[model samples]
Target: MDIHALKRQGMTISEIARRTGHDRKTVRRYLNGDRVPGVRKRAEPDPFDAFVDYVTARLNEDPHLWVVTLLDELEPLGYAGSYQSLTRQIRLRGLRPACTACAHVTQRPNAIIEHPPGEETQFDWLELPDAPTGWGFPTKRAYLLVGSLAHSGVWRGVLSPSMDVPHLLAAMTTLLALLGGVTRVWRFDRMATVLNPVTRDLTPMFAGFAKHHGVQPVVCRPRSGNRKGVVEKNNHTAAQRWWRALPDGLTLEQAQASVDAFARRQDERPRRTETGNTTAKAMFAAERLRPLPPVVFPVVVAEERTATRQALIDWRGNRYSVPPELAAAKVVVQQRLGADTIDIATTSGTVVARHRVVEPGLGVTIRDTGHVAALEAIAMASAPPGRPHRRKERIPPGPAALRAAQVLTGTGQPVSTVISLAAYEQAAKNRNTLR
Candidate 1:
């Protein structure tokens, strides 16, 4: 506009070109009001143009046909192009439907997270869909305690029956051992088992567990699970990739084994890192993890119960028998996380009984054979005496014994029953004399 204004003041095109450092033709175009810039077309033709129709048709057919697959088909037809170039052209032409949700989510600015090896680990609980435990049991929901190393994306997971403190701690211990070590920081969401959501404080049990592992416990912000997005994303990955097709009827131990195997397989796959593509197992090798403690944090859960007079202790709606002597005594039942056995001990820490934990709602009774025998013996020993013990059948008295009894009564003499030969002889002699 300034140049045109100068030109309107009767300046020649040559003078305007010299004054504005513009080309003579540019000056004339501006002066003549031909200001709209001409669109510059590409001088070279696109190599993908010839294959556009084919690509579009293929996309229309499947919508999700891999670009690589399409590239493979095109390569045979002399569509010489790099995969990147082919994808760029396909995207530019909008041949594929745009993933709106994905675009919306990925378009949001996200911080690029970086961590040194063994610096941080993110953990979360994934609730799996209800499935039968393969033990002829009703369908039950399982939880996966998933943990991922932030630096290497090495993941470890264990299936748990519940999300209680003991299960959570036990799962963490197992995952850390599988991961080969612990990280400097352990990250978690505001799960009640891990932290007090309102106070943002670690739960007492988890605090102790963290202390035992020598790792600092960090809780994510409320409602912001993405703070620990590494494990959170791995949770979805595990569920979709592994848990989706998990065989039915898996016991808890079997499910845990399956999860471990899945994690191992995942770690074997190549992952993209800042350095380049590498397997998690390979990267984990370089991680400077903290050595595991000599012993794992105790994940044993305990409950106190009073044994009934029948020597039965009730737990989780099932009865487990203790020693008969423990009847009407207070006992403690300790069940270690991930352990099948339940231990019943006296208040003084004497293990009186041990039985395999039964599934809920089974109405099962776990009675130790020794305990049962002890109870039977105690019952037999305390039975009253002088009572006629009933036999399988009655044996009638002989006719001679009946007659001897009648004679004794007729003589009004005290009758003494004797089994000795001398007594029998004396009774026979007396009988004969009486006769």
Candidate 2:
């Protein structure tokens, strides 16, 4: 159209058409003011017009009814329209009502946090899918206790049989020891082992543990796992990147070792940080962690039990062997939090026995071979060497006489039989002669 004005300004029609890349006839028509823009006409009326009212009514009744379900209903009514046609018409008519609830809710923006070196560590539990146990059965529900240093993104994890207080503490201890030091602050979720769900206060045992480590326990707000986001992300990373490919038939010990190896590999990989691209191992080298205490916190649940005559102490329905000398002695069975072994100790804290803890209801007898050998020695030393004298033989009544006695007893009659000692001795001598 601009070429029309160009033609009026003394440019030839061929020149205008060639410059504008338009046909000469089109350019001439535009100059003559006879060309009109083409008008758009509607395509064939949609085949879905007959059922528009039905869909609109249903959507008005329940806006959430799926478009495919409407298609199913229309198909039975002899409507031969495809799903796309029906959805297109429905969308054009705005049949579905706007969901005000979802529209009003807004997502909160995530703030990037910068953790100073050795300042904090985040801890969380990751519940993994059922995996094959050492027994080759897919029955064990494994949970991994993950701890990550916030500054370095370096993490360590341990598999726990449970999320109870003992398991939690044991896993934490193992992870911290692997990391070689503790952070100033231990950030955690509202786990039952650490905080009371109802009161939202720290548990007494966990408080003691925290105090012993010289760390401040900072609990995330209820339902706010993002507060401890490092370990939370690590949870997913470990499950997807490491646990997913774990070999079949992994024992608890093997799984733990695998987790440790995976953590080491992860630490060596390079990661992006605010400072620059660096490996977690590199950052960890610069971290100034608090020195570990001379002794680990005593995070054990203690129970008192008396050793059985067989020198076996019973705990949680399982028997653990102790020294034979400790038989019938009252001893304390101390199960460290999250530890797989139970310590059998005296009241004075001297450990006399240690056995791998067995699950309840197993009725297992965990015997130390040494204890068995010692007990056998003690038994051998106390037993007499030779056979004792045999008692004098005595002859008894025959089956017929015994039956008669039983019948008489059933009749409530007082039945008795007596024999002289000399007569019994003579009968016994006759039997021996026959033999």
Query: Model 2 over residues 393-418: C-alpha lDDT tens digits?
Result: 56589987887887877954555797
Clashing pairs in 1: 134-249
What does candidate 1's lDDT look like per residue over 1-435, in tens digits?
A: 778788789988899899999899987876676664554446898667888789888887777789999889988899888999988998878889655545745577878677888899999889887756343222477678888998888898976666888767777877888888888998887778887867877889889888988889887776556677778778888999898998866655566678888888888888887678888889889889988998756689766677889999776557899999989989988988657789999999988788998875455788889999999999889878867657865778898788788786795455579676998899999999998
- Note the Cα lDDT for every prediction shown: 0.80, 0.82
Can you give the TM-score per candidate against the true fold?
A: 0.52, 0.54
Residue 391 displacement in candidate 1 (angstroms): 25
Off by over 4 Å in 2: 1-107, 135-139, 301-334, 337-435
Candidate 2 colliding pairs: 166-337, 166-338, 167-338, 170-337
* Best model per TM-score: 2
